[model samples]
Target: MDSLFLVLPLLLSASFPHFTSAHNTAPPPCHFQAIFNFGDSNSDTGGLSAAFGQAAPPNGETFFHRPVGRYCDGRLVVDFIAKSLGLPYLSAFLDALGSNFSHGANFATAGSTIRPQNTTLHQSGFSPISLNVQWYEFNDFQRRSKIIRERGGVFRDLLPKEDAFSRGLYTFDIGQNDLTSGYFLNMTPGEVKAYIPDVISQFIAVIKDLYNHGARSFWIHNTGPAGCLPYVLTKVPVTAGQIDKYGCASPFNEVARHFNVKLKSAVAKLRRSLPKAALTYVDIYSIKLNLFQNATRHGFEHPLRACCGHGGKYNWNKDHGCGSTVTVKGRQVVVGKSCKDPSKAVVWDGVHFTEAANKFIFDRIVNGDYSDPPVPLRFACYRH
Candidate 1:
């Protein structure tokens, strides 16, 4: 595990120097020259700091040698997905230092919602950037890409609007925050259930926006087991019986499944409208659930607890969240604490997954084991 701290930084630094220089990578058999991602922190490579502020420490301490704006301790699921497809890790389009637009640009933000003014979440200060804003940002990115293509810029000189975009894979890993935030706003399970159709409509709208721009390859990840998350458990009342054998809140997980059912149906509707598009809905919830069931076999000792955080049953104290600060002994101290080994834990910071978990999930999705229609991204992108 100690080797992770040493080896990962060297590997990442040696490869991603393009924030300051030009670079190019040959497309794999998938024929996807690039990836353009849009969502929340679940798949945000660095959208937080790129457009807003930075992610605090313990966030990337496990691997990247620093916080790279991902909510996790290291790489996100999108990072692993890119690697699986033999592509460079995607860069946030809003990154001020410059991201490698050649491989792809991420438009996801940490606190994004599917709606522009989702009243429940918005009232609770949870709606920082919505999917609506992300689409607008994508439009701006397309504009910039066009200018760069026309001018024959310093980076990825061969990529033009049609050459790179037409063959690129567009991925989304969002909607978890949109649902979870409703609980914080005091919305009941019934209320939350009623709101699923709105979420589906918004997702369809975003997909249509991308389809109009010549994008045909789509890999969309459904929300994972949010009820199983350690931090979320702290937010609500529960009985011992309510906790499942896997240590997740049964009622909350049911809500997630319910949402997925509606979302999956919506994907079917989208397919009928955009028949030529390759839309693969990945079942992230099942992938994560199976991982929880086989945690010991997968090298995770504490699958329910976070690798970083403080003072809670799951090590995710709400009063002292991961990367937060508190005054201790007349000095400012980081409130959260990190585990002895992060690679052995599935959860990170109570809410997000550890790098190890995200990699496992990505592997399952790419392998066709966890994706709906049993189609892997390799074949899905080729159809486009």
Candidate 2:
């Protein structure tokens, strides 16, 4: 079955993409101190649950050993980036209990979108923390930080104040939902295609807003190969010819490629416009695909199937997904199941990658091969 994970690289293939791997990374580039991350599930550390209080087990099972609201089984790409920069793990902006956001704050959330609502594109709605809302939150954080500084309180732990924001790395890892949500929202292909311009415009607006707010270094990630995701493949219609040699849907991958192309073009235009900013466009798809191309090299035995979820070819049953529940008799019961070795699987659930896979990705990202303009995090991006 095309959707089966129950049934699912080598030589660093040049035909795919080029990424240089250096064991020793460079000093954090440009003396950037802190990192403020903004995105969806891919980079969210704990914002989703903090905002909604809707976390479940098997989420952080492989790493944190508890549900920390992360969609993955462990730390995300931003987590790895933090570690590579010798900085503390970014604390979610909404996690107030025992976290200190001195290093920086994460403003990402699961199911987030760049646009609040693109009705012309038939977007159903927007996550509470859309890109616009996140920007507003950043402004609010700045306001609060300033107030604390004046009050003679130790407020630096809350967020970056004034000059601190200038040297920080503002990372944007969003837009996957914009490209994939329309499929679930029942939007037409032409509607989806037409929506791209608005998406790019809204994205650019934030980059400029951050620049206006004293942000200098920018780390932007292009969307991943959504067509190859277990969640998309299980629900979307896929013909035999649509399935590639690697078991991914060819048409969907093509759509994702098109999105990347446009995203790259948008970044290029931004580069021309924001000449003072040291911006880096990350090719998230190719590095992730490299894991699939050389699965064994990265200790991955299954790249398409998930390590957790209910019964299905990909181990993903929409009705009883990783965090879903089922009513048994008169009581609600958790029906989601998980594999023994999540570290060996490429995916943790149907939509996100496993911690091991994220680590592999961070290795390549820090090495500076998948980024546009190729500023290796080793020497180009430093922490506070």
Candidate 3:
């Protein structure tokens, strides 16, 4: 008995290092079969200005060499998330221009928001497909996938169990435009705050509704620091010496933080209410802050200024936009200039992040030790 006890302890000691190492290792990569994205320009793949002639440049110029409707030069958060999950880049659902749905489709539109009234710099009217409408489009995709499967088509086997409740990832990155709309409409910040909770409630309800429709894993982004955005800063100017250390408008950033807090609480409530649902909050505010703090580390000279547009001091004017003409040093030159390499820049346009910034945010989400109570959506359905 004495000999056996000693051997047992030795065996445990021998295995202890291995066990510790295993525990310290990163979790296995999440293998998502499909990625469904719904949101505004931040996550939009290409769901705006296609029907109309209006276009934004430096948008999709990095990859597709032409405007692809995405508000950035290339690849938004949705694209990065999809790529991280080893899925194909999501195509725009409105892009009947193409017929590929193997990976998934992006239903996000530039200027789309959870609230009904949303606008952009161009004053482009609100998205044709609102949040509710995007949900309907998602349902349509599922229905079409089902029909294809019933026909024993190529994607038949790709569909998750219609009733098995296998969770797929759904990303929501809206609401900035809602606040922007309110601000543009001359509504007080307090009035905007009053109306935001209901917007959040409606958002949560839609997410829960999606859960009923077989979505089990949800990743929702809290609003980014909106006051820091060039458009807002320029439109709603502060006193000459009142800029924060970050050069952001304090009131607007405070509103954004307020929304993020409420959103975090809402997500927590969601986890409690739906024990089986794995919902995670992507802390975009923190990510944005980190990017700003480490701008030089990321190769950005000016985190606040954009690379494109005239004056070359701030962002290009909303009316003139990037890639337009202006006078520079007595020479008439095309004012909107794209950087030699966009990957190094923090802000691609006046509003959105560069593709590199988006990639960094994705890395932070997957790798950062986030404190904001993650519900572990990837592990929710795993059986040890």
Candidate 3 per-residue C-alpha lDDT over 229-288 given as tens digits, one digit per residue, 9 for 90 to 100: 777777665675657887777778788888888888998888788766767677888888
Task: Sort the predicted structures by lDDT, highest score first.
Answer: 1, 2, 3
TM-score of decoy 2? 0.86
Ranking by TM-score: 1, 2, 3
lDDT of 3 at 7: 51
What TM-score fits each model?
Answer: 0.87, 0.86, 0.82
lDDT of each: 0.77, 0.76, 0.70
**Candidate 1 RMSD computed on C-alpha atoms after optimal superposition onto the true structure:** 8.8
After superposition, candidate 1 runs with Cα above 4 Å error: 1-28, 118-125, 155-161, 382-384
Using TM-score, give the best candidate's number. Answer: 1
Candidate 1: deviation at residue 127, Å?
Answer: 3.9
What are the per-residue Cα lDDT tens digits for candidate 2 across 1-384?
Answer: 122212111112221123323532223235556888999889988887887774688788777899887888888999988887778889888787787776788899888889885442213424668899889988788667767766555565555656768878898899888877776776654567778888888999999999888887888888887777888889777788878888887766666677778888987887678766767888988988778767888789878888888887888876678867888898988777678888799988888888999988887777556777655664343211
Off by over 4 Å in 3: 1-29, 53-56, 118-125, 149-165, 324-334, 374-384
Which candidate number has the best lDDT? 1
